[model samples]
Target: MKKYLQIVDRHKASLGTRFVNNFIDTIILLIINFILSFISAVIYNVTFIHFFYFYNNGGFLWNVFMGSVFGFVYFFFWENFTDGRTPGKYITGTKVISTDGKKPTTRQIVSRSLYRLIPFEAFTFFGTDGWHDSMTDTRVINYKNYESERQLKDEINSIGVKETA
Candidate 1:
């Protein structure tokens, strides 16, 4: 733990989970989107012709626009509200903070999301940890301030309220 902190202190960066809980969050979002699509189809009275031709042209464009807007807005709002988490980050118990030890700005969120559009992600083999960290000029941190997070969880699960011995 001390080693991790020390390394961070020296390098201005720290180790954080890279798997990105956004996949799960994205699944949830996809469901929401699916529902929305159904509603749109019903409300717009989009026929098979529209569905095949003009349907996606306008619908797809609107969906992408809305999704981008919502993503940035959600990120900025939640990162400020919970001290740096999207729904995904909250679920995963992680937060993003400025790498320079400052709070993230709205601009950072926009830039971070946009930067993610680049193909630099493919440049890395396994995870986009480095790319993301660099893009936002931010680093993800374990939500718990104490290093005993894991130990505490283990203790709670390992013992019962009653004493056996």
Candidate 2:
């Protein structure tokens, strides 16, 4: 667990970039949601006055529940496949990773995703503040250098190139 919470290289990302990524991701998701809802309504034949009233009145709670569930499902499916990136993180070239330099475990991914609901990782009590930013002890980092160990390999390759030339 401690290894999982390790900090990322400071050069990889900034707080500002993290913020914009989140904002853009949210806007894109909102647009997608609107499109889905429109499709649902159309398929249900909500063009007629009676149909609109019946569907809206009958499925209000269910619709909200399904929407919430869909959000979680979307995050889980995409994040796992994309190496901890949502659309926002992907656009910003950032991702979450364990400190120990390994792909995250299934439990780790789910926990981290749930922890994201902590509202910017901020909390307060007893006249002080606390952050869940370290919940995973994992750091948000630029994806490019996620594999720092690769630097050594690149250096070796560079030396080989010079010798061959």
Candidate 3:
């Protein structure tokens, strides 16, 4: 609706905010990976030393693949279950929604998550929105005062209706 567009246009998130969110999220992911990898190494050392060596030797590409898998799961579940607000988004005071200014469906969240797999998707923030957002037809907006804005919009609408009456 026009009101939704007005709100969205007025509260579009900046690229810097998006970048900071991603930076924080990546740090979280890296911390998680480090802990898991450490645990795995210890387990392998105790059970099968040779297998541990093989796993560690799998090298950079293997690490990247594993990281990508983790990233996909992390983003998908967080966005889907949290109504498009991840830990990073929470910190940044932003939330994702459909381009039409409604909550995104499960399918849309999944599509957005999958798009994160694309190389350099983070850099796409230089444009209006990120690649994940663009591909899924979603947007992230400044949500620090979303409730207040919604209430104000509702009050304004009510006033308009009363005037018409």
* Number of the top TM-score candidate: 3
The best-first sequence of candidates by lDDT reads: 3, 2, 1
> Residue pairs in steric clash, candidate 3?
none
Which stretches in model 3 have alpha-carbon errors above 4 Å? 1-4, 49-55, 160-165
Task: Tell me each candidate's TM-score.
Answer: 0.59, 0.65, 0.86
lDDT of 1 by residue, 1-165 (tens): 111233223332133234455565567667766776666677566455564333335676676676766655555566666666777777766667666545667777667666544454524425435575665566666656522554575688888767678
For residues 35-137, write the lDDT of model 2, one tens digit per residue. 8766657766745556544444557676655555665666666677887778888888888666665566667667665665544442221222123234444
Q: What C-alpha lDDT do the candidate models reach, one value each?
A: 0.58, 0.61, 0.82
Worst 10 residues of 1 by lDDT: 1-10
Clashing pairs in 2: 5-137, 5-138
* Pairwise lDDT winner, candidates 1 and 3: 3
lDDT of 3: 0.82
How far residue 138's Cα lies from its native spot in candidate 2, in Å, is 2.2
